[model samples]
Target: MMLFEKKSPYKQLLNLFLLSSFVLRIVLLFHPITTTSFSWAEIIKIFLTGFLTDFFVFITASSLIWLYLLFLSESKYTKPWGYIIFGGFLSLLIYVACFNTILNEYGGVLPEIGIGFVALKTTFFGLMLFLPKYRKHIRIALFSIAIFIITLIIIQNSISEFFFWNEFGVRYNFIAVDYLVYTNEVIKNIMESYPIIPLFIGVGIITAFFTYKIVKKSMPFLEKLPSFQEKIKSTVGYIALFALATFLVPVLAKQETSTNVFTNELQANGLYRFFLAFRNSELDYNKFYKTLPDNEAFTLLNQQLEIESNATSTQIIKGRTTEIKKNVVLITIESLSADFMKMYGNELNVTPFLDSLATKSTVFSNLYAVGNRTIRGLEAVTLCLPPSPGESIVKRKDNKNKFSTGSVFKEKGYSVKYLYGGDAYFDNMEDFFGGNGYDIVDKKTFKPEEITFDNVWGVCDEDMAKKAIQTMNAEAKTGKPFFNHWMTVSNHRPFTYPAGKIDIPNDAKSREGGVKYTDYALKQFFKMAQKQAWYNHTVFVIIADHCASSAGKTELPMDKYRIPAMIFEPGKEASINPILMSQIDIMPTLLGRLGFNYKSKFYGQDVYHPSYKPRAFIATYQDLGFIRNNILTILSPKQKVKQFDLSLQPSKLPVAFQLYYDEKPKNTIDPTLVNQTIGFYQTTATLLKNKRYQKK
Candidate 1:
């Protein structure tokens, strides 16, 4: 211990470096408060997670490095403890540098723990190299630990996800695969082969023994350690160099690429934005990208916005829609296109039950849906809000702020209930529905006999329908007119028919078999409804969630978003009124028909109302289109415009359509209308964030 020796300058430099790095990380955390909004709880969680993760990683790496060096050193010219102190300082600096760089990139650090994990791995390697002889042992031990920790974290987070899948199997199979499939394999393996704890411990012990053998053969420890002053000099120099490198690499890379940190943060937290940025990797993005909107699309979208904004807030007078509100039972069919039904001019006898029901119901021959997904359809029908361009309304926390039909009915003292076979939390649907005054009945609430959790995505449509009927009957006993929103999941892709059902030879890739099976399930639901006491008074409004596959258009061609919407009241005479309509029109149309006096806070008008204009708006990612009385305006991302006159000439589009086909700003509607339309869109967008119709 050379107490008289001069103190190393390296030690003072290392201390300064750590202090500076800590202050830098603190600055990075506070920077996002001005640009991005994060709750106080969220910010604290981020800081704590970052602090704990880095602290443990540095301690672990330093400890392993020090132990290896102690055993693997020969002369001990450098003290082993000095190397560990250096490693610790280096790891801590690396953590801060990486954390700050990523935090700046990802608007906020809270959601991007992946960066921290990656940095930790890099730090482990750097520590192993601090002393060449000890590198072999450190590598083996660290690799084992890294693999175990990552796997454990994945398994832990997947527990709730797996439980939901086991409870609701095979539902929406074609839609999106659930996390249960991954954990289910692990669970099965755990039961038959190995327990988690023993497996981890076994790996750890093997790694430790292998490391020990390698170290023993490679190098021998020195009998006497070096002077303390000399050790301090070596440690401080190593730390200073590591700290300098950490701060420079990221800055240089970012500068050379012309990419800043803010965009990175946007990608981290903004799901849709991230999805768009990495669209090529996602199956949904590839399918949806083929439909980005052109200038004409935006123009048409703006027109719909104008229609909604200018139309009186009292567009549908109160008491206008009560004529048919006699305990309404609504069914949202999955992937059911209007073109598939025999009544709608399809050659296939796919939906005989729906056709029969339509014969006695007030069939809306020209109804439309706003968006192309289930959530979009639900939002349009229940809330009467237009789907945001290329984004899910459910993902937006402020969705409850948007105007909704549920709020209207709830205001009228009607009990609103929503029933789905899947996890209502997937798209935050439960919170949205619950916030809008709907009693949500999801898979968790279903009875054992009422539902079979055989689907990975959700419960089967048949089981969901049966549950709906039961709930309706129970609610009927209360004497309160109820509005029930039922969504079908069996018709989604990867459709699995019930056992012993007729199996169509539709290719595994073909959705035809699932569609056929879903039709059969729909039939079963209606057949049961006929025997229920609420049948006569109940207004069964049926609408498809979205189109399955449009044969005529690859991108939206004005009719891509077309779906059937009908009102079926048992024992009532049959009537069909065809008008150009869409998902936005459902709210105003339904409210008007039911004789509700409420003014719709929607972008749609009643097709039946004499003064109401007949228009339809459809969107596909960035693409949008407008349809009126007999004219259709098509817009594409390429700025191509195509117009068709449905009245005088159905087959041929006008040459002038091609003139405005590019639909440049000048070729579209007048400037005054454009500004007015754009203004309305901005206003409505603001309303969505304001929580307008939701009860505080």
Candidate 2:
């Protein structure tokens, strides 16, 4: 019996595609990480919107298959120009395969399943296209393979999405898009984080079962090809649907429609979002977001700058002439949060060394990271600008020769270098840092014997620490002050380290293990540093690139961005400074403490400056956040602005409450704060886009 009355025998397969997609979404909806506070009506709306998104995603994806099968008809298959159809398929395959590896040499990845794999696929495809008698058998084989793979992919994606939501509290976004560029690190990280073999075995079994059932029902129907007229009619009908979807999807699938971010996320398909993110990853502030007139924006910004500056005391120790020659060591750790240490309220004592070091260092008790990514942290500290919408400046193209914090060191006759445990080419770090007057010392510079233990991310923090000392020691011998910036990696996922260094065993593969090991490495690093000739002259700045997790119910969770920053000078008395600061402010504050002054393009201001007013700039790729005077103002895409009042959580235990916040929606936006918020983000976006963010 015919399974369908339709001209296309693959109708049942399409139904499976839609049904399976819907089922996956229903599972995600009830996921523990997904919010359960939605109203019944809202839930219905989510399903309704999701169905539309799924259909459009399906249509856009299936258009090529429609074209291929339509051309495979006997009438078209034997035509003189039939090779064009085969060439088109080959070209499409190659583009998709190679797309993720465009930046292979520059710290971008050439994926493990790269060009060579795609070529093999092309050869198989050519055989199916040229041989008519074997075509049906080949088609059956191809359908089975494709069906099996697609089943595995959607299932795997569902599993991946669950983990992603558990970690970051949202569907795929620019971070997922960024992962494509660094496929090796991400793939290895996943391997270390999960039991991949068992999961794949389970998934493959499920895939094989579905493939058998689907092909048994669907491919036999394809043996009796549709009449030429029937094929044309069906093909035309699908093409029209594809065109309609292409038109409607961008209109219907606006990402941030609802006030609740997760609600908006649940209403979209993950694969569609991933493709959309790749296409529109960087949203233009002026185009997609609210903005003031350029002159008015800058005027408000300059007014805020001057007004804040004039409100403070200008007196300071003013002898930068010779004291500027002091050496500086800046250590930016991965995912180090304030709550991970005893110095904060962490009962776990995961960072005993950092806690002890805090007793001897000036701790910025209220420092927050600008964004939730490593590249953003690097951009914040180096460029000292408000977070640019879309991608960080460090990863953006044409991001070279900027007036960064390193430029300040270079102008002050200091040797500046950016040292990392991993490849510097990743995230365009080498290009950005090297273009901005810093020497790059990364994984490639290390000798095999120098690396005692390593993982997919890079060398362990201890190994990198030793390298930092060696590099700085060599610079110290040259008789010049050096600014050495070391970015660590042990505090990252699959957080394995050399065993027995800390009380935590290496095999546990936990964040606590990572944090404790990082603390131990710091103790060892400082022990080695103190014995060096450059020790007495050096000032160490320890800060986080960003927190480990930034997930919360709120759109922009304030507490998650809270991280630690400390300035440790040898033999200096430790003091706790409760001034609110962002990652960008640390460099300006450090330079001010050292009494070095130069042409400034940095948006960050030293809290000690009489004109320094306290404010913190925080953001995601699309949400521009500004926190000051107990108000959090966010500038989002679609010119939407939101304001929330931030206050310390009321609790009996003061220590725990200090690091967190309670956000209450404001009924109205403050005009002054809103203008300043717009001014800061707009000016940064405009300046960077126009190549005007320079020390003039």
Candidate 3:
């Protein structure tokens, strides 16, 4: 096709940009795994709204080339300095297109190599700027290189988006942002999950084809350049349109055409959604969500507190006794949801060890994770707080010296520790957990001989388990009660572990394999623990950080947040507690059973307390959900509050329930329930903002 006139090379490039986006976005929309059946009207609306969203992103993205071309006269374009500087950037892209992918696939990537390359390329390119004789030849060479690099990036992003959608069922969100922060793990994960090299080289022939077409179309540009005045006249619309798109962001966001969330998500542009997610990554609760006056909120929350140390005066208290206190070992497993267990309807037997262990443990049947991410889980179980909107408290600035579950243990004379199998610095865990007064044990603490199996996420679960046993044994020798909080990391993407350890083959490289292998490791740990002197004295608590997948037809599928929670001790009661509780409640409930009594500032309540209320907190980056009386109330940004019917039954082992929007919010919203929800979150935001939750 004749994309543009011979005189307008910029127009040809611009046309290709929009056309490719349309093709790629539509391909994602029609992807077999992600898409659900929709009406023809919904399809057209998705296309129309998505096009508008893409146009906004294009205006902003094209500003890169737009600004480059605006002042780029023949004199500037012909300069040796310009070609060499631009070529330096193209070199970086080439490094990423080839070398970066390979390094991630094998094992790990070295940032120091990239830094040294940058320094070397700068010196080499600087010398070229002095040699004016090579300007024309270098400029032509760079043009071809630029075309090739751009096409490679386009193809790479398409493959990544399709795979990301297949996993998460939406465009780029906060989770993708987190992946960007930890590129080494994310890259290795993508490489392990997919055949990146074969796919890239095989599918990359299209890159060469497009580069040739784009090069041929731009050949006329070398002969003669447009005059500055003509360029200004031709590109005036670009500036106007860019400003208009920027202004329309908030206005266009309110235009929701479909009731089905999946359709609305499909209608959105990936880059635009990413920009929105980034912009609101750390939202201030009082500013974004519905709230009440601090005094009134605190009073309402205090009224709802249960009797005997469950009050919220100055701090929160779950129980009032330290008589049953013993050495504690809390294991927070990664992405291990209730559905993965055989008792919760998983016939695959991925969690056979946990299933068998549950028979003699205090298994909570309806425990809901407060949020989707591991950081959120850590925040809830540690601080025992409702997720404080936006970033978890574990990652936020000024999260130190707080009233955490660890603080309670320390106050009760137990030596406390925070343990992880991965680098604690990944999610700011090192700072958060360390600042709050706990002996830290992460991948950095592992010695050369200590490592038996390792991957992008650091040591495997078995090694970490062995390390935990060692740490506990050391504490036992000290003759002080120990409270160890250990986080596992084997059940994640690109899930590889020590070979021949489980019934599932290691070559599967699947989530099932990951779960089963982690289960095997847990079993091994217990068998060895039985031989230890402190085995009977220590109370073993097992739970998941969060569910594996949080994607569903509705925003927060009630089932996706349900995880297995069990407390197994040698002579402890093994009854199944059928109460609806949140991840935040796990620690407090355990403490209650242990008879822990300390001044506290946590939102978690002891389910065993006589006056304890049955509620669960669930949330995403944007929406804050409070569930009570089978109704779900979500408080969102712009002071938006909505309610839906959850119809959750405590008797059900795992609640596979969806949010029914068809039900009237008025019917679901009890005035007292709404007020309680608002008061709980509003008071939390107030307390955290003022740093009032600090340890005395």
Candidate 4:
């Protein structure tokens, strides 16, 4: 009867924990917080796929606990201390489950079992507390691990919250992971945007209390250990089972289909996404995704672009400009959404100065940004290309000495400079600009005395404006036309500006206040520029790096991508153009306005050119969008293409749109629009993958 003494109490506890984890995961999956509804078959598929990922996590977490149980279970001190450790871990699991459930309720998604892996890491630290020999150091070690775990959870949750708010509950994909490489900048931005320390402290206290209560309750379950031979056999069996589970889980869990991006993302685990991001940061267009034959793609693209037969993939167009030597200032404002401006029908007057300036400037009301991130915006304007999948070229390793806007300016014999309020080193801006022949002028170039007000992001907008004036004034004295790309930072979160500069009080500290302050800074910058001799001769180009919000039901929301773009000339009459334009169009359009004749490789077209057709290119990290002729076409990986009709006021009435997949249904879809979308995206992707953005 004693031969197989009913499974050890420890093993019983392990089984209960694993079962509880599975049930908890299944419950969360059924109660998914998503805008889209799923069919029963889709739900079943999601559950089964999700279960495999959860099972793998469970096996990994339990195996470590099993190893500890098998080796240390026979020790005289193991039973009492092991029970305490297990209870503490169980409490952590409960806490994580509670946290995740709450997060889901708030329109967030996390891995069903990813928290177990996180909790398991914390549980190992509790092992030291179980050793009687280290009793003297137990309190300190336990406190340290508790604080560490709490801090990590708070930080990660904050990041998830931000991403969900801005990216529509998408998990940490390749783009998100790429952002992590800039740890210093990311942490500083987080600290500026949130009250991180206080929030973490509150969470820490609550978690600590639960952990303490569980440990106290488990102390009473102390019992004598089984034989050594029995322990060894259990350890061997557990290891073998764990090995088998690891090998089989991924195979059984088929990769989720991408019928719908939001649905696919809803079924994905956040932790698994992070791992996937790291593994597939860079995608080969011809391999992982759909692509047309190279020659056919080029033929279509050449026809759409209206290129000559002899033109290369990276063809250089000769610009036609009369005022090529005029001073140019390109001011890229941070988080300046078109929605915030009164010109865009906003009554808040968040950008009063900009609104007034729009009347005296040539404004493009229908301009859209290429991507959500600042780097993407920069790439669009500088490189003048549609966004490639994965990371922006600005952040990539090979981003140096390309045929950029700066290179074009340099060739025009103008002194080109990239002016940033913050460190230009962030996001590899310095590398990209420096390699492209632009002088870097940033926070480091400013004197301590010159900086009147500063925050984690950078010096205030007013200070940067003054610095720009000072720099440009010097350049003016040299009698050479100067090109300055000034990137402002005050519109960013934790927006702080000098007192009395704007109607909104500095202490108000809100996004609206930030927008107001940025408007005020622009007014001051213009005031200072007007006093200078070079002011009248300078043509100022003002545009937003990207919009403040990027979240929506559709991956590429038309309204969210809309941004204000203007060209201000002293004597020219102001006019508004409603033609569709993209961020990539900025450079070519500017060159055309300046009447500069030069050979250039740019994907953007001069909007004012006689043969130019109006269209805009917009994208998320993976979805390429082409908006033209009141129709929007989106191209995704896996040979997927989606088209939507926006002829019925898309921004005002999104629900009225008609959606089509693959081929357009009868006369419902425009065949020409479909061809243009496919040609542009496929050709651009092919060119980027083959390093053909520059002359070979």
Candidate 4 deviant stretches above 4 angstroms = 1-169, 213-266, 308-311, 320-323, 647-675
* Every candidate's lDDT: 0.53, 0.80, 0.78, 0.71
In the range 463-531, model 3's lDDT, one tens digit per residue, is 998999999999999999999999999998888898889988876889999999999999999988999
Q: State the displacement of the C-alpha of residue 367, model 4, in Å, after optimal TM-score superposition.
A: 1.1
For model 2, residues 119-199, the per-residue Cα lDDT tens digits are 766776677668877978887787677667766665677777777776787788889998988988889998987788998
Instruction: Point to the candidate with the largest TM-score.
Output: 2
Shift in Å, residue 117, candidate 4: 21
Give the root-mean-square deviation of each candidate in angstroms.
15.2, 4.8, 5.8, 9.5
User: What is the Cα root-mean-square deviation between model 4 and the actual structure?
Assistant: 9.5
Candidate 1 residue-wise lDDT, 513-622, digit = tens? 66776777778888898898888777778889887743121234334466777877667687777666777776566677678776556666666766655666665434
Which whole-number lDDT from 0 to 100 does residue 366 have in model 4?
80
Measured on C-alpha atoms, candidate 4 has an lDDT of 0.71
Candidate 1: segments with Cα more than 4 A from true spot: 1-86, 89-325, 505-509, 549-555, 629-680, 689-696
lDDT of 3: 0.78
Query: Which regions of candidate 2 deviate over 4 angstroms?
Result: 1-10, 30-32, 74-136, 306-324, 653-657
Q: lDDT (0-100) at residue 333 of candidate 1?
A: 85
Where is model 1 poorest over a 10-residue stretch in terms of lDDT? 656-665
What TM-score does structure 2 among the candidates reach?
Answer: 0.89
* TM-score against native, each model: 0.58, 0.89, 0.88, 0.78
| lDDT for 29 (candidate 4) | 38
CA error at residue 71 for candidate 2, angstroms:
3.4
